[model samples]
Target: MTRGPGRWAVLSAFTVLAVVMLLPFVIVALNAVKSPAEYSSGGPLSLPHGLYLDGIVQFWQRVNFGQKLLNSLMISAAVAVLATLLSVLNAYALGIGRVRGRLWILVLFLLANTLPQEALVYPLYYIAKQVGLYDSRLAVVIIFTVIQAAFGTYLLSAVLGDFPKAIMEAAAIDGASRWRILWRVVVPISRPTLTVLMIFFFIWTWNEFFLPLVFLISNDTQTVPVALGVLQGDKMMDATMSSASSLLGIIPAVAFFLIFQRTLTRGVTVGAVK
Candidate 1:
């Protein structure tokens, strides 16, 4: 009887929530092109008079943003690929192999994800120095690969556990080895899920700042987020420049999300229905 009113109510609530979520990005975009004088005179919410790109340009040059961007891309891509592989192997053994203590090991990985990075910094830092990996992008990649793989293993394990026994049986009957089944059968069937995980891993590692900050001390070794933090610490930084830096920092992450949006949607839909 009251369905129409309830429908409108839910729609209205979601509309407001969407705006709240997007307001910051909109404001940043609006100000990214606004001259400082215009920004000061018109305030943040007001429409910009015209495009102003100096701040973004200056910040990019100052930070050698190209190098930092490359560092981030290299590190995030390595972590995504390496972590996904590591997770697949671990999850395959524990989930599909039905190994003893699999449940406990999954639980351990789950718990590991919850442990604060702050708690491990000292040990990680000490180990990096001891291994002569400190302040190197390789060190950051190795560290984040393991950190991200923990979550990946936890997730992929559950997904693979429910994999159809009939299909597995068929593969085994066809004289397929475990290795072939993994590569040819399970992997192809699970490609969408793995793609989704890779996207998440890439974005998660891209936005990571703390460990990158601690480990990547050199300007060339730093990532976008770490570079943004360093720029933000400058006493001479202005609000307009701050907005520019923030916009620059998030553009790659947003681009990646958009590029994989279709795959992400399909993967999620498949996961839900399966």
Candidate 2:
């Protein structure tokens, strides 16, 4: 049947893509468990003589992985929530209402997105310092929310554009306020998009390095990426330790995706269905 070939093609494509994406992780895993000499002498693709946890153990001890993870989680979670809410609100306002200046607003967001993040870093850093929030977790969260909001808003607006207008009219007929409609109707119906947004926001905030690298000076406030950088430098690029830290830094995002992959896929397809 046609279905058989189509299924095989899809599976084959996914397998190829997965292998491509996971190559670095594969290297990290093997190197994570390799002795330092074995790590350097063994090529990235080579097998190790025996499993060793020294690199991982040392990284944990040096970085205080638990505390860093907690900080990352708090910052990431806060950013996700704020970004999602702001995105949803913006999308609903633009999608459901007749705002005269909607096009200009959307254009401004798109223009900002086109500008490289590096271009604005200096100004944003100065502003953060002026606000007395430099080096704080709250500062990171706020920056993450603002920097990510444009793309999130654009994506959510596209999804909302495809949402059925009949539902909005019916809710209005039932005398529902915009807030009630957003909370009771739109959000529940757009659950998939929201999940995808949250996952992406979490990933972005968790892995953010450059902003944190520039702004945060205190070791205690360093996120995983910053911590990993310090570790990598301390080890003078010791392959085992570098690889172990890389693996540790990546696990949370990978696990999060694996846990919610179905929702992520559904979100992409559903949001794209115009």
lDDT (Cα, 0-100) at 53 in candidate 2: 90
lDDT of 1 by residue, 135-252 (tens): 9999999999999999999999999999998998999999999999999999999999999999999999999989999999998899999999888779887778889999988788
| Model 1 pairs in collision | none
TM-score of candidate 1 relative to the true fold: 0.96
Clashes of each: 0, 0
lDDT tens readout by residue for model 2, 1-274: 3569889999999999999998878888998899988766867778989899988898888779988888888888999999988888888887666477877888888897898879978998999889999989888888889878888887777678768889988999999988998899989999987988898998888888888888777878888888887666573557888888888988988898798899889989976783
Per-residue lDDT, model 1, residue 259, is: 91
Give the worst 10-residue stretch by lDDT in candidate 2. Answer: 229-238
Error of 1 at 18 (Å): 1.3
**Over 4 Å off, model 2:** 2-17, 40-43, 235-237, 272-274
TM-score of each: 0.96, 0.89
What ranges in model 1 sit over 4 Å off? 1-3
Error of 1 at 73 (Å): 1.1
Per lDDT, the best of the predicted structures is: 1
Error of 1 at 200 (Å): 0.8
